[model samples]
Target: MFTSRTFKINKICEYLLNAKVKRCYPKHILSNRSVHDVIDVDINGVKLIFPNVWLRDNCQCEQCFHVTAKSRIIDYNNFNVDTKPVKVTKNSNSLQVTWDDGHKSKYGFNWLKLRSFSPKYQKKYNDDIYRSPKIVWHGKDFYEICKKHDYKDIVSSDEALHKWLNDTSVYGVSVIEKTPNSETAIDEIVKTVGFTKRTHYGEKFVVQNVTNTSNVAYLSSSLQIHTDLPYYEYCPGVNMLHFLVQTKGEGGENILSDGHYTAKYIKDNFPEDFKLLTNVQVEWSDVGEEAGNKFYKLYRAPIIEIDSNDEINRINFSIPQRGSHFPGSIEDVVPWYKALKLFFNLNKKFAAKFKTPEGNILVFDNIRLLHGRNKYEDSENNVRKLIGAYIDWDEIYSRLRCVKVKLNLID
Candidate 1:
């Protein structure tokens, strides 16, 4: 939306009418228009600011003006040299130069209504290379960890699967619809894709029969939003829940929050704690349900991760599942506890719960979305059982962004 905003446009129009090589510097006649002001420069050095859109077509880059591999041909005749020139600068030593775009070529002093040019050794720009992304472990080892599951094909089309992934990755969650019931269906959805069923604490993939529950209180209980565990290695970044049966209750709702948002909010507003979470790796563990044995493990992950371009990219949140603090773990030093409290409070806003039916696969951006449920009344004899699965971070994103590129939908 950056644009020219001056009344000097009429001055440039006058130059276009004359179309002479007399106009070069428009500063004298510009009527105080700023250099940043998009203008029309006449051969007479008169500044007549022009509309912004009119110049987008004047690009000399290969994307707009197809160049040969040699790039030696100078299409000077096609240059729209009649436009008014803005303020001009010179090389620190001798020749008078014009404008500010890193170009050092000496020309006919007619750069009035055009883009500034310098001796560009390179002609193309690649934004992806310049970005400083924080995501690590995208190399061979990570692939080896994922490639182990090994299946012929989870989805029918590579292109189609890529498209479907974006819908789930960008948003906090995605749904797979029209699936029929059975353990076979669950395996078909996740098994071919090679998802590791991450289990820690006591909730990895707990399945219960309505008829077998000894605690009657569980039949009517509501689940709060929590990570699968606060302790465990990797903490399983993908969480999927499939409904086998719909409860007859009138008000049970599912909710989710984006850790990406919570992390970014804190990074920008609470620099200190954001610093803490990224600076140190914490330990997490699960106290076993068994009376005699307990299990524990640890991991190193930042609460927030940004891409090379510095966009809020990913989140690793499952604090409750973390093992015991590591030896020599730095104790909380700052008023960061207050900021941590506030960050989780902010996550409270992303809660979104709704009724789910059989055959729906609710997939979450395990690194980002916090899942929970609302309380509902249920018949004592008929409790509900939920089926679940998992997927990885890299595979899902690769699929989603590929589609976004084709559809021109990525933000």
Candidate 2:
């Protein structure tokens, strides 16, 4: 036997110890359907406890794992990533498992944990904030929902504006209403939020062309749909476009598109093109600023940024302002050009647009949502001008995500 009363941890030689697989409360089980987990076990010589949703991950089912079933097999990507340990209680019969997708299931902890002898999870769990980054769940409908919320309010409070800001990061867009149609108030509204930070963003002219107050009204015309600060090495992390004057033209609409979505749309539809963008890091530059010093930069980032939950986080795209391309060190330039062409076409495909009135503000998660204008011509001398600013994505995301359905949903 391993021990007389209980198994001695060490010191005895394995040959003399005569140890056996008395019981295993491992973490995961591999099966054709998918991997499952265990929380408790009643076997001897072993103990295990499933971590709270912290250890589980989104199911790589057909819905999420759009790849082949063979490729879909649980790989290193499927395990929990934190570094804390979860204990399995010996003599415990049943175990509970909460998945990353907010799913709950129970399995005989022995069944799943035993099958999961592999490095199932690496999450570090403790009742402290110091544990790896706090896992914040941002949903897919965040953008679409926030767009709807923008139209319902007349004047959102300071607290309300911040909540909307956070929603912008989580959903990639947010809206504030009830902004007075005055230049001073609009400027003050954005300034109240303070400038969000980044090594490369917001230090230069954060509010794009704000000093040129003369053309503010004429510029609000349906502006071309394009990303902000694509030329900079570090693009504006977040952008705030506050509209003080909304009623000059009938349909002075603001359009937006999630570059992440467009990139995916092209990737799944046009594989060859998608490969070009992802394979090579495109370079962008900005110059010829008649007013200030020309802004120029070249940075490297994937066009489509998807997070751990398979959700698009940011879209690094600015085709019109694009400069030379840097296909991978080994990659050829042909694919790079091909992907750029495809991205431009797809970006033009399913962009979103919204109309704003006075007292309305549109906060864009510049990393993900690209903004543009339709076409506005001051038939008369009347013009459309908006006061805007740029803030970091982190600030915006924190405020809105906590607003779980309790805040008024503008529907």
In candidate 2, what are the lDDT values of residues 241-357, reduced to their tens digit? 766655465666776776776766776888777666665665665444334444445666666655676555556766555566553664456666667667765665666656766
Best by TM-score: 2
Which tens-of-lDDT digit does each residue in 1-411 have in candidate 1? 112233454654454355442243333434545322453333333323333323433433454344466243335554443333344433322222232333222323233222321111011111111121222221122222111111122255544454345345435456666666764466666643455554532333533334344322134455555565434445566777767666665656676766665677677887887776555555544444332335545555545555676665545555455444553244653444455466567676645546666666677766666666676656655456567766666544444444445555432
lDDT of 1: 0.48
Worst 10 residues of 1 by lDDT: 118-127
Off by over 4 Å in 2: 1-144, 147-163, 184-194, 197-223, 289-294, 306-312, 325-332, 398-411
Task: List the lowest-lDDT window of 10 residues for candidate 2.
Answer: 123-132
Candidate 1 backbone clash number:
45
Question: What is the overall TM-score of model 1 with all chains considered together?
Answer: 0.51
Question: What overall lDDT goes with each candidate model?
Answer: 0.48, 0.50
